[model samples]
Target chain A: AQSVSQHNHHVILSEAASLELGCNYSYGGTVNLFWYVQYPGQHLQLLLKYFSGDPLVKGIKGFEAEFIKSKFSFNLRKPSVQWSDTAEYFCAVMDAAGNKLTFGGGTRVLVKP
Target chain B: EAGVAQSPRYKIIEKRQSVAFWCNPISGHATLYWYQQILGQGPKLLIQFQNNGVVDDSQLPKDRFSAERLKGVDSTLKIQPAKLEDSAVYLCASSLDSYTIYFGEGSWLTVV
Candidate 1:
């Protein structure tokens, strides 16, 4: 079974502060990774995804993630965040064949204005 | 296009009661999924359907849970004699292909 591990459970930062959330998966084969965000009372929305190709992938809302195969890590980063970025983030991974998706516990990010 | 649609945005039922949730996947989508998300945790797959046939239901508690997709379009998930632990959100998602799944606003369930 594949599992995703997110290091931070909660993070608080001021507006304009940079943010980074660590995500690691336990899959040994070709995998597809994704970052989804859920604002308060809102449905989950896609942030970005890494299927194949370059190691770095950029997503909406100025967010980006680096896929390091050696470490099995796909850490999400945002150089500057806004108050609107306050939401819970989830990291999910699925096998290349597009099987079941495994999600991490999730990281709640609160950006103070 | 209209995204996935779900009904009964919220429901509160007593223990041992039965509840059902309905979902309509995006048009032309061949895959539908039902996920259960407990508070403070990510969504977990309960059942998956390819068209009108089921693809996976391994995580579904068959003893109390049941789901179906009719005509390869809309889907319904039901829980009979619900338990307090079943208090969570039920999310419906769909995809044209197995990957790139799109989600809908979940239906919240509270068992007291």
Candidate 2:
């Protein structure tokens, strides 16, 4: 079965700290990768997605993710974090068929002001 | 454009009870999806519909779960004889094609 894995279950960082959330998928074939974020009591919002082309894709809120095909990873990164960045992040992948997204367990990020 | 909408925001039901959730996808969208999201986990696809036709229901527990998209517009998801493990947030999403999936504020279901 295809699956996504996020290594860090919980991450705490201070404001202005650099952040990286690891995401890896277990599928060799072509895949579409996505990163989504959910603030407190809010709906899931798309942060970024990699369909094709440039491996490094920039998304909303100063967030970016790089898709490394060799590693089968699309890790999200942010240079400077803000307190408002606190949220639960999820990594998802879909195969070439584009049926349904297979999501990871998710990572809880807490940024201290 | 308005995003997908789902209601009620929250529900509390007893075991063996029947509950239904309503969802209105983004206007003119041809694809719609329903997902079950347990606390601390990502959303799991329950069923998908493409203009009133079932696209996939492999993950849906059809024995007690049923969903329908009539007229290829609004949709409804129902669970009969709900179990405790059924407690989770139900999410509804829609897409123009298939790559981009926009989700709505989920309906939280708590089966006690």
Candidate 3:
């Protein structure tokens, strides 16, 4: 069974702190990676995605993720966090030929202003 | 471009009651998906449809749950005699292609 794992369950950081949420997938074959964020009372939205491209992919809202094939990881990162950045982040992966996504348990980030 | 739309932002029903959720995918999107998202967990794919045909439904609980995407544009998912564990957000998503999927504001269901 293919799965995605997010190492941190809850992360608390002060405003302006750097953020990194670890995400690893179990599949070894070609995969499409994605990071989605759900803010309080908002629907889930795409933060970034990685396909066949440069390992580093940048997305909206100052978010970025790196797809490291060797580690089977696609970790999301943000240099400076704001209180508005507090949200639950989910990492997801899908096989190259599949339309279904396997998502990891989400990481809840709280940024204290 | 309008995004995927879902009905009944929230619903509360007793165990054994029945409920249904409706979704309308983006115009011209061929792929539609239904996912169940429990609190503190990621969204789990329940079913997928390509146009009006079922592409994958391996995760759907066909015994008590059923879904249909009629006309390849709108869809409905229903649960009969809902269980307590059925309390979760039912998310509807659609994609033009396999890579760029978009999610709707999910229909939240609480079975007490």
Candidate 4:
């Protein structure tokens, strides 16, 4: 069975501080990776995704994720954080041949303005 | 385009009661998914349908949970005799050609 792990459970940062959320997955075969965000009282939305080619993927709202296959990691990062960035983030993975996603324990971020 | 649509934004029921949720996917999307999200955890995949055909449902609790997409457009998920642990947000999502899934405002269930 495939599983995802998010090392950070909760993170608090002041505005303009850098941000990084660790994500690791357990899978032996080809996989598709994704990062999703859920704002307070809002549905989950895609932040970024990695299917093939180019390990670094940029997404909406100044978010980016890098897929490092050798390390079995796809970490989300932002150069500077804003108060609007406060939300819960989740990392997900699925086998290349499958459509179902396996998500990790989410990380809740609180950005203080 | 319209994102996924779900009805009954919230539901409250006692243990051993029955509850159901409905979802309508985006137009032209072939894949629809149902997920259960606990208060502080990530969403867990419960079932997936590809145009009225089940693509995956390995994680669904079959003994009490049932779901169907009859016409490949709208879907329904039902829980018979729900448990306290079953209290969670039921999320409905859809994707075109199995890529870039979009989620709807979830149906929140509280099993007392």
lDDT at position A63, candidate 4: 93
TM-score for each candidate, following the candidate numbering: 0.98, 0.98, 0.98, 0.98
Docking class of 4: medium
Cα lDDT tens digits, model 2, A4-38, are 99999999999999999999999868899999999
Q: Write the per-residue lDDT of candidate 3 for residues B35-95, one digit (tens) a residue.
A: 9999989999999999999988999999899999999999999999899999999999999
Candidate order, DockQ descending? 2, 1, 3, 4
Q: Model 4, B58-79: lDDT tens per residue?
A: 9999999999999899999999
Report the candidate with higher DockQ, 1 versus 4.
Answer: 1
lDDT of 1 by residue, B17-82 (tens): 999999999999999999999999999989989999998899999999999888999999999989
> In model 1, which runs have C-alpha deviations exceeding 4 angstroms?
none
DockQ of each two-chain model: 0.82, 0.83, 0.81, 0.80
TM-score, prediction 2 = 0.98
Q: Residue-wise lDDT of candidate 1 within A36-97, one digit each (tens)?
A: 99999998899999999999999999999999999999999999999999999999999998
Q: Quick one: RMSD of model 3?
A: 0.9
Off by over 4 Å in 4: none
Residue B39 C-alpha lDDT in model 2: 91
RMSD of 1: 0.8
